[model samples]
Target chain A: MFDSKQFEKDAAEIMARYDQKKAATLPLLHLVQEKIGYIPPEGEQWVSEKVGVAIVHIREVVSFYTMFRTKAIGKHHIQVCTNLPCVLRGAEQVMAYLKERLGIDAGQTTPDGKFTLSSVECLCACEIAPMCQVNDRYIGPLDRAAVDKLLQDCV
Target chain B: MASEMVLSKRLKNPGGAWFDAYVADGGYAAAKKVLTAMTPAQVIDEINKANLRGLGGAGFPTGKKWSFIPKDSPKPKYLVVNADEGEPGTFKDRYLLERDPHALIEGMLIAAYSIGCHKAYVYIRGEYIEPYRRFVRAIEEARKKGWIGEAVQGKWDWEVTVHRGAGAYICGEETALLSSLEGGKGFPRLKPPFPAISGLFASPTIVNNVETLCCVPPIIRNGAEWFAKIGTPKQGGTRLFSLSGHVEKPGLYEAPVSVTLRQLIEQQGGGVRGGKKLKAVVPGGISAKILTAAEIDVAMDFDSLTAAGTMAGSAGVIVMDESTCMVKALLTAAKFFAHESCGQCSPCREGPGRLYKIIQRVAAGQGRRQDLDVLLAVAGNMEGKTICVFADAAAWPIQSYIRKFRSEFEHHVETGTCELGHAYAHH
Candidate 1:
């Protein structure tokens, strides 16, 4: 389901950055995910072929990292930092607010498929505690007002 | 004594991340000096004299680590900057990356030169998008200015690439980082084939933390003795302590290694939040043993914290107040370790999850009297029995929390409900 020529070209460039082809597995998976939105079974096979490693090996990498999404996600993926630092700074309340407002528990997507809320470990942004990463952007010390604003923008 | 801000000197500059601003503040001068004038051995000697330690977590002596790279190796020597700042409560590397990207780049240049490396990589955490972009731009600026890449400043050829890590806390481990760099699951390799002996494409490699490398340029410029005199006798230079949780002022503070936990918490952190009494403190990262409020008078250096039966690991310094429940706190820590175990080794894979499950049960107000001893025994088994210290790190919080707050745990068991209410009640 992916563009083979484009994938091969990008994979070549990434592989060239490393001494060994095996080292490009994570980057290749990321590239595929960026392009395809999620890592398909076919995409994993393609990365395996490109990196010259076994498909199972690529699958191992894909499944190991929390960032790699195997299934399709919502338009906006809200990753709340629920680790210790954020927890201490009222992340539990922030998480509760999101769950109640969104009407979905952690790791669940909205029925409209507009939002997927997941509680993540430290995003290493404890400076702004009780934070959440909405897609590529980090929104923090999240209150009802901030989360409401975020939902408004997403909608 | 007031905590001196050394590494964070240029952090407040409006245009700090820009190449021109860094140059104006004498950024690349040390890299240039090391490349043109100083011998590789001389650079190593200066760093050794400075006594800088890895600021990532371990606090291994920096110059001594560089000295381990085999001089006669036929393979290309690589200097890997561990910018994957994943340790909970630690955010100093993020500051260094975002505010002073040039400093880290310059530090990398000097480190690469000392170890005779032509190529280096900064493996930054995937979540740090802004820091990654800043670093990438800084590298481009350095290249254009003739500071790095292809016979830099007409002295030596050095190149740096910023590699982004997929989300995995285990990648913070040096060997696991190399494995991740090689595009594998972030599983740590066996040591003795340590990074120095056989690392990254089977070459002799030197992996240094981002903050540790940032200390290099200043040491080179001012000489090792000046850097040495910054802190204590053995531990030299200022460290970035990421003070968060229960603190009035929760942010990154650059203080000397001699700075006590009390100084960091009271003086820099503005004491506990809402004028509450301090309950406990994770002196370092989540991995370090929790120090009770009274025990926080100890210095935050590596040896002192170790002497206090904890570590100055990653210098995270997560503060907890009296309102916090020990059971819930330990549960949070246990959950983090459980989620990030890598599952490569049996003990680490199984131990963390079991600890989390047991802690979860106890936190939920369902605990056997025997559960406490069971938790301790499981944690003890996990320690010193894995491919990497991740198992040991996971075991630490379990052992320390139980030992320090046995009464709190007993309360959970007896009352059939948590006194602090269910923090993880939603989960």
Candidate 2:
């Protein structure tokens, strides 16, 4: 199901940007994760060979960064920022609201596998406090109206 | 006000101006002038005279940092832009990157030419998807116009690469950023071999913050003296202060370094929300020591803030009103440091978690009088003992919050409840 040939072409292009091949490990891991929804063991091995780094080092990078997830999340991943700034502006209440609305806790996915909620740290969108990243988009200053709209759209 | 705005002037345009619109506004004129007329030494001299310091919290002089790069280095030099805006209360770089991205590119052009750097990398955080896309688009536009590629302006070969960081706050550190850039864990390296000397691929590398780089073009365009005269004698130019939390109008405000915390909060921020009485303010990002309401008269610069017992870290002004609970506030801050600690150094790795647990117990109304002393002792032990200053930063909130708000913390421990809430209910 996965297209290896096209991946090799794209991986090579990414590797060419840096002088050393190891620098491309993050980009390559990102590409693989985007394609497969998660970095499988094979994905790690592929990046290891492509970037010429050992598997252990690849695992280190994957584990170190909070964004890199080994398992697949739900169809929609909702990351609520609970850092100080966001917390200052009632992020705890917002998280509670989302949890109640979705019938799930902070680190859990819905029964239908449609939504995954995560409590994250400062996304640097403190200007729009009480914000979250729904997939790749930033939705924030989340009031009752915004949460309702988000729920309607998610369904 | 229009003329005074340097970095944020172009942010008035909603999605930012395209390359054509940016060029129309005399965007690349400084870079062109630097490449055609001025020598690298002259450019560096101008920056040195301007006194522009790093806006990414360190307050290091930009020109001094550039001058550190060895001119005779056999290996190729690099210019890595620290767009990793991870500080809790700081969001100024996000605006600079998303809006007026060309400013950063043009600034990078001048910087790379001044440092004889042919390659540049912008390490943006993984969370800033929109800003990252907007920045990459700006880079492509510049490259397509031959402003950032091989033989830029028909002068020298250069290229700019955009690298996205996976979420790690420690990666905001220069050496940790270097390690992350090299595709390793975001653990910081020892300092003797600074990045300027033995950096990226063991070559001379200069890592400048996004806002710091965005200040470069203006410094070259206007003479150094004009830029220098705008702010304090030691640190020149305006800063993008991120005013957040309980402010009435929470947004980015460009102010001279001489601007006071009182002016920024009362005047620019439209005073605190709902006309509430101000209780405290984090004059910098979360890391800086907290300032009481009485201390709001101090200026919002590196030197002035340090004199006031706080650093103007990233120029993020977080205002808090009287209704807030200090114990709960410290708990939130402690939780952040605990979660974000990279676990490399023992003090930073272990210290923050302990602070969070202790604060959590105090907030839960199950704390002893001895808990306060233990918190102070643990925080004291964490400071100045780690490989990086993260331990110091984590310790600051514990030390400052307890020291400043001792009575409130004592009330929480003795009565197992917040006095602020009790006072409010009674009133």
Candidate 3:
């Protein structure tokens, strides 16, 4: 039901490390997502068969790590830190500003496919509170002004 | 020419927001050294030669772990900084995040190049708002200067993103960290496909401790031989050991691996607070075996600590003075483990709760002597039976405490009260 070429290769590699193939589910999820930019729905069964685990086990692993994106993302994925530290440090206002600035809420993709904005839990750089991550780079400690400057740079 | 170990690179700035100050003090210069001069292989070779280990509890070899990433892989690779500093008695990562944010950025860049990764993530703890803000500004500074992002200074295209973790201690695990970075619940996964080949966004990934990754540029710039010569034969370079609790100087200190615990306490931490007699020390965070004053002479390296039946986990030296009770100390540590259990495995979930209840019973003056055996037996069975070492972490202290301080536990039960033989107030 899916293209198993990349998933098969990754599953084989990750599973080889373990005595049980079933244990490869988590690693496979990570590998598949990295290879394809995101995990397609059909990649689940491909992984389960390769790792010898049930499809349900694969789902549990996928559902567990939020990084395993079910759908495709824009070229740039903007995840704003909305957890307590960031929230306390005005991460909420940053999200609102981004929403107004981008004309999209936290979890929506812009029509241009350049940015997908989402309010994520925390970015762990609490000392640099009110931060947002664009793809693999961080842009932050924003009030309305700094976030706007970041958005301008992104666009 | 001779060099010496000076314990704790943390106070290098000594306090306040000084990004420019860190740069002026030969900080990012090391990173620029690697970025502008060395090739990826040279960096990796130097790290491998130094024999540095991750300070974040797990003690994995830093260079070897990075080398495990498949260089010729057909996928986009990543380097993630595991800055989720949730381990109790551990406040060192926070200082690095706040004080030397640029150092981490430099280290991340070096690590990213060595592992053939242009993309990197700094996975930090959720509660570190102030630290996160500081890092965000620092990262912006680096990016604007073109030290990071899309072929800076005629180098390769690079990306360093900051990813935050929610308020869950379990995310400190590498696998759980990757999960949290991907925007999922902070639950740890069974390892083996280890973060090396399979990590962050799934590509060939290298998940390194913040402190561990921070050591890379220096090793790369100074050469492996220079780096290796700083510490003991096997353990190399300086470490930022967070010294808190009853210490007079109670702050982060940087010394090489050969620095003895006594020197660290006396010279760095300024000895126990208010001249309080040193009773016991939780050498490395809450999980390590507690050491009494006699053992204070031991050095603070990975091997020496292991020989002493504990680890220098995250180098957070938590000192306990005479007034602290053993039961209370063990309980404080146990309560953290119990509360932080991710509810994934039963041995850790039920086991920690049971251990907590058993210890609580003994503390509340409702103990039988056999309860000590019960605690040991339960803790013994729980070890090595979970998806993560959290089980072993939860069990190790109980087993060690009961073995070393069995008298105190027995005394509490016999007297039907705290063994310190004093009236206890609910903390």
Candidate 4:
């Protein structure tokens, strides 16, 4: 199922950028995720086959960073930032509001799998203290009212 | 000047790291241009010509840092991406990594190729697990497509690894990152040997900020001349400022460093909450000295910020509107640094806690005039005396708050209670 020519082409380009294959952690991850919707549970082994490194090396990387999601999620992943700034600005209330409205706890997907909820740290829009990530896009300074409005708008 | 490109970069079909989506949006075209067209020296020279510096506090020239690696070094050279977005009041990296990890990856590939590194590491904060996972997953996709393995592009051998730090602020420092990569305590080391010349596993390394490296893909693709044209003199390119606090629409903004706080606040942030007037701003995070409402006209650049008596550290613009009690707000700020202190250095470990205690005393309606002087003395003594900037970071708000908001502080002491309403009384 894997296209070796395309693999060689992409690998050549990635190799041209760095001096060693191990340094391609984020790049390799990005390439894999972009190819597959999410990093396959066997991503480390898959990458090991692609990049020619020990699977453990890739495993250590997958285990270390939060950016790499091992589990499957709904079509849209929503993250609520409840860091100190957001918390100070009512991020907890926003999270709770989303929970009550969406009817799912953190890290749980909706029945239709259209949405998944998780608690993110912060999304830089601290001025709008409470923020969230709907997939890749940032939603912020979230209040209970704003969360309701955003949810309605998203649907 | 070019706009803040990172924040404004297209957030579109990332295509799961497939070559088509990346290529469709003009991805490796830049790397191909660099590898076949421009020599490594020429690429570095192009960056030097642009006059870009490290956006991460230190104004080190971008090209100079890259050039620190020897031309013919035998050992593995590395280009490490500093994705450890740990600085309080700073969260731009998370936004970039979350929304556009591909751009950073593209940039990393270009930087590694240009710097003669066949390997790269995106050293991220462990707490940022989700963001880190997305980034790593993206890289995996790149690897499966043969973009990260041996004979990449049919000739170059390169690899990228993601090293995650275990929730330590000091790990943001380059040496600490190297130590964490080596499975050691995340304490900073003296810098006779910088990371560029001697880094990770004693090999030459180029540890660039996530935002900084992310800028490279665009620069290389668009040309250094184009990047140079953006921002202001000496400060090339845009900055991603994380505007927080009591603003109407607080969020991230990517604008030229020339943009004033007022523009970022009034125009982008939708003004203060409930149309409240501005009080002061902790420009560039807690480490930066407080900027009074009167001093909000300063440009958000390295040189301009320094002249205005503050540093553009991480571009974390924490706006403080009126209704904020300077004493209590500062006490909160001091407490964060105190708690986050690594305790590796006494200046930070002991000083921030003591500063918090003093600020608490002042906030709790019990203070002395000498206490003000003691706060200044504490901050002054801590400066340039620690292994890392943590002590100085802990002390800056204390010293700067007292200097800029002396009247408010004196009012707290005079009234034996904060004059501001309940909002200021507690967090």
What local lDDT score does residue B24 receive in model 4, on the 0 to 100 scale? 72
Q: Tens digit of lDDT per residue, candidate 3, span B187-249?
A: 788777777777766678888887887777567656778778887888887777776567776
Whole-model Cα lDDT per candidate?
A: 0.89, 0.89, 0.73, 0.74
Q: Indicate the docking level reached by candidate 2.
A: medium
Total clashing pairs for each candidate? 1, 0, 39, 73
Worst window of 10 by summed lDDT in candidate 1 chain A:
A1-10
Give per-residue CA lDDT, model 4, range A89-114, as digits (tens): 66667878888898999979999988
**Runs in model 3 with CA error above 4 Å?**
A1-155, B1-10, B14-19, B421-427
Question: What is the per-residue lDDT of model 1 for residues B250-365, given as tens digits with 9 covering 90 to 100?
Answer: 99888889989999999999999999999999989999999999898899888999999999999999999999999999999999999999999999989999999999889888
Off by over 4 Å in 2: A1-3, B422-427
Candidate 4 per-residue lDDT, tens place, B146-240, comes to: 76778877656887777656555667877877765654456677786888778987899898998887777778877788777786768778888
The superposed Cα distance between candidate 1 and the true structure at residue A129, in angstroms, equals 1.0
Better of 2 and 3 by DockQ: 2
Instruction: Give, for candidate 2 chain A, the lowest lDDT window spanning 10 residues.
Output: A1-10
DockQ of 4: 0.14
CAPRI-style class, candidate 4: incorrect
Off by over 4 Å in 1: A6-9, B1-3, B422-426
Clashing pairs in 1: A23-B182
**Candidate 1 residues A1-111, lDDT tens each?**
567676678778777877777877887888888888899999999989888899998888898999998999988999999999999888988889999999999999999
Better of 3 and 4 by TM-score: 4
